[model samples]
Target chain A: MSAEAERDAPAGVDGAAPADPWRRGRWPVVTILSVLLVATVAVSFAVGVTAYPPGTIVEVLLAHLTGRPSTVARVDDVTIWLVRMPRIVAAVLVGGALAAAGAAYQALFRNPMVSPDLLGASGGAGVGAALGILLSWGSAGVQLSAFALGLAAVLVTYTVGTLVGRGTESTLTLVLTGIVVSSLCSALISLTKYVADPDDKLPQITFWLLGGLETVTVRGLLPLLVPVLVGLVPLMVLRWRLNVLAFGDEEAASLGVNPRVVKAFVIVGATLMTAASVSAAGMVGWVGLVVPHAARMLVGPDARRAVPVSALLGAIFLLVVDDLVRTVLTTEVPLGILTALVGAPFFLFLLARGRRAWT
Target chain B: MGSIRVRIALATAGAVTAVLVAGCGQAPGSAPEAPESSSAATRVVTDVTGAQVTVPATITRIADAWPAHNEVVQMLGAGDAITATVLIEKTAPWLYVVDPALREAQTVFTNSTANTERLAQARPDVLFTDKSTQIAAKTTELGIPTVQLGFQNYPDLKKMVSTTADVLGPAAQQQAVAYNAYLDDTLGQVRGRTASLPADRRPSVLHVYSLNPLVVDGTGSIIDEWITAAGGRNAAQVTGNVRPVSAEQVAQWNPDVVILASSAFVAADTGAQTLDKLRADPFWSQLPAVRDNRAVINPTGGWHWDRYGIESALQLRWAGKTLHPELFGDVDMLAETRSFYDRFLHHPLTEAEARTMLAAQDPQ
Candidate 1:
């Protein structure tokens, strides 16, 4: 396919001609998104409750990078390094991981509407976090429990799917089982909230379910880095196979890829990434489902291009949204609410336009 | 295929059994009809919600649903009348330590919703709940006289105490007067000392309700009321109770004094550990309060003293002394706490027990 023709090709048509996987326009889209992400991060650094001028922000960054003591006010230095920097990094990591996992799942399932939480990772994480808050285990315990339960939820879904649909449609069984498990997890979360002390733990769980990056710190982000990177590297490396798996099971098997094995790998990678993101930032929605569609609209249906583009777009989108959350009002607005507010309308607009990203 | 079918059946059976076992804890049944009220004398008392509730002349068996108001009932010398309570032993250890009978009281409510069957089973003549019209109406339908009470300021607290006393009887009414006098005396004393202090001299106090989410009690909250009464300005510019703000926002506020609630970090420990953790954080360490060691945990008694509990009298004195030690140098919190417990709670606290309470620790 010619580069000019690929630019005009409907998104559904890009999936038909999979031979010309690498379009010439992919680099420019990636480059623009990369530039936008970098600019968003820089701008987020300067935006916070504590106003730091551009010069002061740069000085703090330089001092930290060079392993030298900062001469600016200690409060400003701490605010920039300890509070804002960690929050900015968390927003990027969570947003990128969620969007990348989302793209992988969408390609694996051959459904444009698939989100990272479609398999019940977020619901399970929410239950874990609620239990931690009810037990007064503090922030570390909440994050740990959320990560563990998220993985457990997906595992249960997979096990049930395999056991019940031995010779039937595998993906359909998995999706049905996922819906069952997600609702179960949600009910468990509600039960935890109901039993929590209304004066204390109830508000904590309520706020956590709404999702925010307010509590994220440098030390808190350290433990999550390993899982996020572990999950992202494999998805990026196996993007071409994910694209091939987008075809039906028979076609994918004929194309020299074991459909079931590839799908399993994609599920594991997507689950890890989604769980880590949910554990770090509580129950942030819409980015996973919406960002991948935007990415496909920009770079067509090839996972090799769409996954990376989705990561960049997700990071930029969440970074900007988190900046607004902290700076818009004196009190921090929940991150999940803002993402849905922004994502839902944009999604409706996309649907209204009839982009043919999916049949 | 046959073996898989068996496994699925077994799993389905297991799930159903688990759910059935959970449901067995609370039997599915409507509450038994409450007995008709005795032809005894009745008096009308208006609650905080402006509803005039006709309470029985003598309320012996009481179901106190509001956890904080349980302390108020105890303070009014009606501790024995409480037949059912929502005060968990873990949440309010001091209350249970003082009145062991509270441990035996049936818990008819979890969080805010009352189980009507359980409430009727408790057989309380009067049900004390917060300002939830739904709960009040539900209990009223069962023929239980539900008194809705809540407070957001010192005046409202005094009104709640008076209304609670109205339901208890004449003897408790005297205790209410005494308690209200003590509150006014303490408030007047604190205000008399700190009233003349200039704005610059008054410290900007940040009441840290929780550290992980960094929630602070802002203006329009009872904590804000006490902060002002104790001669400190609320550092949080927002207006609400337990509003979560960013750490950077707190750093910007740069409060002169950071008061940690007893349950700030965890449910169990005194907030000293939470204070230590805050001082260790790079963000908090840079704050003026942490650097100067001005951060202190608010002492919790029957309830958090800084909250809307009856201990606001003690909180006023404590805050005044903490904020302006020079002005209130002669005050001894241990002696005041001992006297308060003896006079109000009817529990003669030893010196060590008083110290533990002042330190915001559970009684051993």
Candidate 2:
């Protein structure tokens, strides 16, 4: 901790007030993270249960890029392009979406502990997926139901909050209503699990709850892209307003930014991203709660910088975890378990260090 | 008017006391009669869970909590004694087709947990459930004799059926002997053909339990036992039941045969739809099994044949025939199914019904 403080002291040592290094070194940090992300993605392509030589991977990529047939066997090409690539892309999208949503949510609520599922998206999506499995609705039906129900849950919470609170401390009322809706969604999920057939549907529901990226296909990846982009674009555009809203609601209102409008946009964008990620990956935890904190620790509490940096860190974290999940054993380890296993300990370390990323 | 009402109440209370005395007298009179009844004759038998339970020698009422064991009881000719059951026509359709009386049985359990009040109302002389310590202890506390039956392989299945028969009576005991003999004979026949095959001759087989999450039955499971008995190696290298694996891992294993378990749901054509979806996937389409059209759905009967059920007897033959048609060319599956169901289940199937069962479709 002292070492980090000393390293960061240079910007303030020359007769100036203690200054945040992020404002000055933002480009360098962003550049290094971007390069690391690209390198991780490239290395992930080469790692799998089915080993392919570096040359063969390059040749396969070149063939796909130039619209030429690969000299490698069709099986190898299919394994690379169809099976592994879809999973990798899904990991990046899901991780990035969850973390960006988390950043937006924490900024909106002015709470460091908040995650993207501050409302009821994950809980609602879980219930929908469990019901779909119990009813034998297939994979696509499950994904669609999950996404719709997730959005519906947030909408219900927002509606209840507005109706009850009117205009008096709506944020607090929203948080209260969100907890209520989240628990209701959890009970519904449990009901679905209870009625599911012990032989078949129970195991499927259990596995789906554990969460993984093994089921992602090229066709399925396309629908996920729409909601994630729709959610992320708005959050990135409204990042500065998120910082403004960090100062209490009355202060933001005096500063000419309508706190209510910014908060609504933030909720909608975060809910959309959270729902889309959960629908695709099935309740992947910790990425949303932990990655934004890591990003803020790296680049200070500026949403404009933290949001994108959190997206990159999350993408890298999940991609590496997924790579380990697939390659470490013949069987697939649930992605949520690995993320928690890595995130929880790292979070405790951060807490022990007592670095206040949030005031 | 108040004095008259008090007199009437006093008279009623005196009559109620007189009737209560008579009821007490009848209780002692009926106490001796209870020992003279059939329930007085009790015998002890050990279940698969190794709990020795005292049961009525001539059991008349039973509560069957294990869905798969419903078929076993029906096959043992004790379907009429099942007063309570966990499964209905929707969950186990074939059981209903075999014994319609089961439709009228009390559904005293849900999600494998029994409602004790309903189960008590059913007045079951004995309770049968899977090997769950909780259920056994709960039912035992209710004074209902609990028999826990479960199996992982063929021998354990035989023990389960035999224990179930022991709880049933002498008639079912005789039937158990016949059923066990039939299983032995089938295994002997299948193993006689498959045992001589060299390692290179046996193809690697993958048993997919579900396709949505790509869960497959790995080694050390009932699926693996049958795959081995039918002269094939399990493609899943891991050791667990119903393991989730990646498509890339499947491609790496590149099994020669892919067997999809029939959907437990009642909806028709789910297996075929899953097969089509697998065919559409570029990763699955290129596998040796898919390329050569060797990927097939496992036949289901009273329960999924590949699972831990009595139909595993049929699965032994079907898997053998599917894998090594050359060696088992003379074996006619329709005749085998017809005879087996006739002798064991006591429900003779027509050629069309047998074909439907073999195709893993619902009885039409």
Give me the candidate number with maximum lDDT: 1
* Location of the lowest summed lDDT over 10 successive residues in candidate 1 chain B: B26-35
lDDT of 2 by residue, B185-274 (tens): 989999989999999999999998777677888887888988999999999997757777888899899999999888522246566776
Tens digit of per-residue lDDT, candidate 1, span A1-359? 12233234334443453333345342355554555666677778776655668898877665655444456754455456555766777788889889989999998888887899988999989988888877766467788999999999999999998988985548989988999999999999988865554554575687678787766645566555568767876787788898778778889899999888877777888889889888888899999999898777666677877887788678777888888876765335678999999999988876876465554
Query: What TM-score against the true fold does each predicted structure earn?
Result: 0.52, 0.52
* Global Cα lDDT for candidate 2: 0.76
**RMSD to truth, every model:** 23.7, 27.0
Query: What is the lDDT for B37 in model 1?
Result: 51
Model 1, native contacts kept:
0.00
Off by over 4 Å in 2: A1-22, A167-169, B1-364
Model 1 residue A4 CA deviation (Å) reads 25
**Worst lDDT window (10 residues) for model 2 chain B?**
B25-34
Q: Which residue pairs come into collision in candidate 2?
A: none
Per-residue lDDT tens digits of candidate 2, residues A1-359? 22243225323322231266335332344555555666676778787756777787776555554445556764455455545665677787888889989988988888888889889999889988888777767477888889999999999999988888975647889988999999999899888776554454675677667787766645566677668867876787788898888878889999999988888887888888899899888889999998897777666778877887788678778888888876764335678889999889978866664355665
